[model samples]
Every structure is written in structure tokens, then in C-alpha cells.
Target: MHSLPDVSLRYGSLQVFHSLEEYKESGVCKIPGAVTLGKFDGVHIGHQKLIRKIMDFAHANSISSIVFAIEIQDRPILSHEERAVYLESLGVDILVECPFSREFMSMRAETFAREVLSETMHASYVCVGTDFGFGCRREGTASMLADLGRQYGFQVEIAAKERLFQEDVSSSRVRKALAKGDMKLANALLGRPYPVMGIVQHGRHLGTGIGVPTVNVHPGANKILPPDGVYASCTRLPDQTIRTGITNLGIRPTVGGKTRKAETTLFDFQADLYGQTIQTDLLDYLRPEHKFSSLDELKSQIGRDRESALAILPDECDRFYGGPAFEFHGQG
Candidate 1:
């Protein structure tokens, strides 16, 4: 087994494991669980429904609720750290971030169920989507999983697809909405504002020069972002305080900068935030990023953006201010 030193981290009541080996090594596997497995890309409404099922089953049966998050090769809608935070907020007891190793991927579906799910994890029950697949080459189906569950002395629940506007709610759908800069539709599908989480990094101080001092964050390469634009945003600070802001997410073309970053100027706030991990929720798209004629022109547009952001952010703040307390574990 591949043993990693930083195998797990804790967030309040939630325990996160990097792999099945870590979970077994940590002895958390001794506690039987109601488990669900998925990529859980965005943890949107569809994913939430499946999670709720496992949580409820675990609670009723006096077992732990486990989410086996398969780490795939595709770029994620939410990064691993962000997904961990979201799962913690959702009250998951154990989140196993199972790496998609070639060896593990080649395991037979029956072997996976018998060894990993039954023998190792000690799952009392399992939940998954109706279209779930497993095993090498995606050969396992929901019915196959059910049969394996019976053989393995576990119960299986396959949740129906969650739909919105007569279409299935999925990570791909959310990505498409973001790609088009449709914050409204994306938020509607996600059942929350789209979030960008990162550490505050020092920038060129251009915003300060223009009298708008901003906090800059580089979204990682794998994180999918909305089309480069100005957005009405709500930022949650290190102290768990939420502040309204105007976020410009793009390569600063007028400044001749090439890196894509989110530079947010928080309204009515003036505390240094360098190196702090913060979550900025994009509420509404204001406008596409534009290169202005001069610094003065850029500053004027930012002034207008702040006003527009303020107008749009109050209601958003009211909605999400006290909803969930997100803690950054320095995983990013």
C-alpha cells in the first residue's frame, strides 16, 4: 500500500482521508458506515440528494456517513480543498479522497465491492446515482452494484437523477453555465452562489494606485472559472466575516499582465489580507473584462462596478451571511 504522511486532515467534526489506505491505517474503518461514492464535482443539488440519503441512513443505523470521492483526471468544478470544505459543511463524517491509480482502476468490480467496500470500509449500506458505473472500463452498472451488495451483505440505494428546468442537474451543466458567464443560472443549479477559494497573494498594487486597493488570488490551473469578467461578489474573510466586493476575474490586459486571477476590491473594508485563504462567491456577472484607454478610465469603470456590486450584493449577503461557517485547512 502507498503510505502518505499527510494522509488526513480534520475540519471541526469532519474527518478527511486522502485514500482508502489512509482510512484503514487511521482505524476509522473500524466504524461501519453508510457510504456513497462519486467524483462529486460541484456537490450540486444532484450530489446533495445522494449525500443526504447516506447521511440519513448512517444516522438511523448508528454508523458513520462516508463519501468516497474518486479523484479523476478531469479538471474539477471545485478543487479538492474546496470540495472538502463543502462536504464538511454538509455534515459528512468521513470524506475519503480516493486517488484514481491505474492499479486501483484495474481492479474488478466484484473485488472492489468485496475488498474495499465490504472488508475494508465495513459499509452497512451504500448509496449512488441511478447511472453509476464502476470497475475497469466502466463495466459495472447500478444493477451490478446491487447484486454485488447482496453478495457482500450490504444494502444499496440508487437515487434518481435530479433535474432542473426539465434537464438533469450535473457538474457538466454547471460548467457550461459558468463558461457562458451565466451566474444566475449557475447559482440556481448549484443552489448557492458559485465560489472561488484561494490564498490572498500580493499583487502589483495597481488597485491601490487607483485608490481601490484589491486582494488578488490565483485560481489554480484545474479550477474552472466563469468567463473573464467583473462580478458582484461576497467574500468571506479569515474571521468568518462576509463582505461585499467587486471582483475582476481575468488577465489584466490594460496593465499588460498575463496571469488569470481574481482581484477583488472589498467595499467598506480596509484590513490587510495577504496570505489568508478566503472564499469569494460570485453573485452576478457585471460585465466582460475590457481594456480601457488609461488608468483613469479603468478607475472610473471600477467606481461604477463598486456601485453596481453594492446594489446587487445586499440581498445576497442577507441570504448567505450566516448560513455556513467555512474553515480553511491550508490544503490549497
Candidate 2:
């Protein structure tokens, strides 16, 4: 398993407020802005549409654009780091990550409006999905929010939910797609390849003994991984270099692997990446995970997986790896 160092993280130029008090300490509550509230698990295309609408409205009104994101009760679809990076790239001026503790979850509908919507953030307009809810036992509805806005002197705007391929797009839908090894559909829903960010950890040097080398990454508990399989993927190095690679997300049965991990072997690169943070973007699925009878057979199969991956992926590594293509696709 990988270990993450305890440290404060930043998202490009955008400031992240981890708590309401922290936001108040930053003196941002004084700034009038249009706000959106949600858990924002994946920040997928559906989320993009909602955020863009709020941003456009705020811009037209010459006010700030803020996203009041809440912590998810379940395991998060994307790591906090990945979400922050994507939100900043989407042109959000501020990200208020409200803690979803027991006390906050028990707050009443009216109190949420007064404490968070009116006094704390000082929002002029509030935007949300048609199904959005808040406060104690989800007693707050979009309609209730609009009425509350009227009482608090703010406007409420509700954006229609997004539908993709006759089915509504959602973080849970993306996860279901990944669970079935459908990276293509998942990519379309997310507007980018699936990315998992983590520090490179030490592993049994089975690859090297078999004449190939790889870096092993252990995703955090909250980060959801695609179904176990061999994938055509790309890696972003700490130096910002994009490297073409083949990744495997599964337990190496032949090598006696016990835990599921993301293992990647880059083409034409030989360097030590242990302890360095890296992002591996899975572009396409090549094959299902299998149990090999021997190391020789496993090595031969890997050679085939690499060739198949190269045939399916772009020849120029930077074309889709770390360049502009990854901007809104959640590679950062």
C-alpha cells in the first residue's frame, strides 16, 4: 500500500477552503458571488454543465463564482486532489469544501440558508440541479431552496440534469461502467480518460526479473478503480514528462500478488520513481485480468499486451498524455 504524506495541498491558482471557519478566515465571505452546492464526487460533464452555467451567470452579473462542495458520506469517486485540480481548471473562482460531519448533516433547512447561504457565503444567486437537496434529513428541495432564497433575498437557479446515451450521467453511473470494464463509455461520461493519482510504491520486482520494469501505485481507499484488467495507459512524471505505457490493475496471480494495485511499465524509459507522485490515465481496455501458469507465459503475454496497446493508442505520447487533451478530461 502507498502512504501519503500529511500536507496542505493547493489547486493551481485557486484557493481551497477546507472549512467554513477557514473560508471566513480568508475574508472571502465578504465577496458577493453566485454559488452552487453539491457533493461533486467526480466533477464529470454533468457537473461541468452546472458549473459553467453558474460561472456564466456570475460573469454576466460581474460577481464571483463559487462552488460549495460537500464531503461525500460514501467513498469519494475522485480523490480530493483530483477534484480540486479539475474544479480549478473549470474556472471556478473559489472552492468551499464543507465538512460533512454529523453536526452539519443534522442542520435544518432554514438554518442552512441563513448560516451558509446568506451570512457565511453572502451569495447573490444560488445554482443547483433539479434534484438538489440539503439540511436535516434532506428536507430541503430545489423548490424549498427557491422559497428560502426569496426569504433571504437571493435568487435560485436550477439546471436540468444531463442525459448521456438515453441514460442520465452521474458519478454512480461512471462507477458502474468502470465496474463492468467499459472504459470507453466511462470516458465519454467523464469527458476524459479515467485517471488515478498516487505515490509510486515499492513492489516485488517481478517485471524486472521477467525483463520488463514497472512502477506500482496504491490508490487511496476513496479512489475507485476500473475493473481489473490490462489497459492502454499513459503516465505523468513529476518532471511533467508524459510517458506512454501499459497498465495492469489487478492482483498478479503468477507473481503471488495479494493486493490489487495499479502497475505500469513505460516504453523507452528507465528511471527510479519510488516515492514520487504520479498520475496514470487509462485510455482503453485491452483485455481481462488472467492467471498465468508460469512467469515465461506471463512475460510473453505482456509483450503482446504492449503491442496491442501501442496499436490502439496515439503514436505521439504528448498528444493525449499531459497536453491540452487532458485539460478538461481530469488528467491533472
The prediction achieving the highest lDDT against the true structure is: 1
Spell out the clash pairs found in candidate 2: none
Using alpha carbons, what is the TM-score of model 1? 0.91
How many times do residue backbones clash in model 1?
0
lDDT for each residue of candidate 2 in 1-332, tens digit (9 for 90 to 100): 11122223476666789988899988878998899989888888888888898899889998889988998777777888877777776778898988898889999999999988999888999989999989999999999999999999899988899999998888889989888888778888887767888889999887988888999998777687888889988777766566778899988777888998999988778899999888888888999889999889988998899888888676433434434444221121
Give the per-residue lDDT of model 1 (tens digit) for 98-211.
999998889889988999999999999999998899988888888899999999999999999999999999889999999999988898888778888888999999889988
Candidate 1 deviant stretches above 4 angstroms: 1-10, 318-332
Model 1 poorest 10 in a row by lDDT: 1-10
Give every collision pair in model 1.
Answer: none
lDDT of each: 0.85, 0.82
User: How large is the C-alpha RMSD of every model relative to the true structure?
Assistant: 5.7, 4.7
Model 1 residue 221 CA deviation (Å) reads 2.4
- Taking all chains together, each candidate's TM-score versus the true structure is 0.91, 0.87
Stretches of candidate 2 above 4 Å error? 1-9, 60-62, 315-332
